[model samples]
Target: MTKEHILPKWMREEFPELAREPVFQGSQNEHDGPTPDGPRTVYRGGKEESGPFNRQAPVVCGPCNNGWMSQLETNVHEPLSRMIRGLPTVLTSERQAVVALWSAKTLMVAYRAPHFGPRPRPEVILPVDAERLYQDRALGPMMVMGLANYQPTPYAREPLYVQSFTRMEHEGGAYSYCATLRIGHFAAQLVRCPDGMYPPLGQIPPHLVLLRPGASAVHWPPSRPIRAGAEWDSFVNLPEETGT
Candidate 1:
């Protein structure tokens, strides 16, 4: 039981709408379910659980979980949630960074989950830049982020589905390791590479818009009432025929 890292009081003040955010008090062990990996799966929500960060999983540790990260959650919550609730959103670089950081944080915690057991394979696990993220509250220089919308399940309770996978890309005489996260209607991909080896967002297979660091905002969903599925895999494994 992680008692020390409770949700901070300041969060409620910053995002009062959080009061409406539904909290799932289901048995953690019962709620324990298999999380999707490339083709296999790993169990999440077991003996120990952290959470309710704005009613989402607070899967990181004390200092790494609150304050700084909380601010990122706050900045993007409204826009992201509104987009999920069927509204137009202008995703700015700043907000996109929030998506990247939050996705990376989720991956970081997943990497540390006990169910992965002793000595999980290194390639499947994300090399999280937690120290850099905690210190600066920003994506490390090597990381790039992007986003897109997908069809949703009709009238489903707000779902905060998030999934990540690691990939190796060869560039600039080295491999650029990256991770992509699918969260609800949007997917945020973060790539960390050696200096000068970073690839731009356009290289990603999905027709995602580049969440360029420090770039201007762009109106997303280019269409109205964007819908998303209930599961993370729905977005991650979206058919190639679908548009972003």
Candidate 2:
């Protein structure tokens, strides 16, 4: 397995001011409550239970994890981190593609976490498949990606969030998988199944301020005015399926 730094090096490089800030990682804590099925591990930010928490995930293979995946991180880190830090920036269509690739990579690693709970069973796509997918510039029919914004509460501690989830879909499908990675108040949503298979995250609780990349424009510090039918919108108003 390869060593993966949860917080990519580009984070500090892009935002030098935050270089000295403490970075927190999520750790899988022991399963506590009894469940009908069995015990499942609990998840908490590493800072919650320990003094020093190194941000690392060592389960991915070296070549695949460090090579192409690392490249993806490098390409997207600046824009994604800026989005997370609530900094002013614009995400072009190409930039959006990079962010989607990085988001998928992050979700794949998080899937290895013991406490990551149940998700829609993912299709096994090998490293070679990744190259093929990348070249094609698509995550296939099973995956969908979108962006969103939110205003963080004063007490919010974690700047990043990564997890997988499933929904009882609108159709007959019982488990439609979805994954999300949020940095600061910006998030990239990836659904591993087709639209209409499940209700989109925007349609659910904690509705998000969704971002439409090509159709809309993004300006940080929310006070900046965005044009009508643009990138930023209430989830309820967006199309059911919007992503590359």
Candidate 3:
């Protein structure tokens, strides 16, 4: 029997809506994909594996927040369970040809476009303000972050549902995926000051946006699109590597 895992409670309380979004749902495990390409499946480390980023057992969690969403750490567990419960048991070649292993880790999220058009795609795993969470030290011995989905966008032709880090779900207002994904193109900071320590201003890196823009220019980089030949693009970034 494979192991199973669940999603965190904060996420369940944070986002009350979930659905399948299969944009790049491809798999290397299926033998019917192309003409037999040698031996696709392999047994390594004394275990049978499927493909790169091979499915791992999940840490499934909850039917909380009125059953809007549930989470799994990975696919090795419930994906198969879901597949089994959602399909027929009778075996057939057509079904075999279409057989696929679910990768809960590869679960797709619907990111509704915000003010920015052309849309943005984010990594499945989310980031959090670990330092802040750790500062309290009581939140948990460890800190982890999560993403939010299923927000209705007002600017698009249809209400957009995006994956983002800014929505305070219970508050009833959310930062749409459009605006959320855009804020990721520049460098960021993870401040870990010990209550009463400050760093010199001149040594700071140029790309961080303050979450709350009050007095100063809110000092953070604004998200923009790739100008066609940029080397790389990602949201998770480190702030200026100034004073250690």
The prediction achieving the highest lDDT against the true structure is: 2
Instruction: For candidate 3, write residues 16-36 as lDDT tens digits.
Output: 332121111111111111233
lDDT of 2 by residue, 1-244 (tens): 8766555767646555544444333322222234434553333333322111235567667886768877887787777777776666776666766766677666555555433333222332234434545566446545566666645454645334433232222223222434555555666666555443533435522333333334455444344322212232322122222221
| lDDT at position 67, candidate 3 | 29
Instruction: Identify the runs in model 1 with alpha carbons over 4 angstroms from their true place.
Output: 1-61, 115-120, 124-128, 152-162, 169-174, 194-196, 201-206, 222-244
Task: State TM-scores per candidate.
Answer: 0.56, 0.57, 0.21
Off by over 4 Å in 2: 12-53, 114-137, 155-164, 167-174, 194-244
- What's the alpha carbon RMSD for model 1? 8.4
Q: lDDT values of the candidates?
A: 0.48, 0.49, 0.22
The deviation in Å at residue 127 for candidate 2 is 12
Distance from true position, residue 198, model 2, in Å?
9.7
Q: Is candidate 2 or candidate 3 better by TM-score?
A: 2
- TM-score-best of 1 and 2: 2
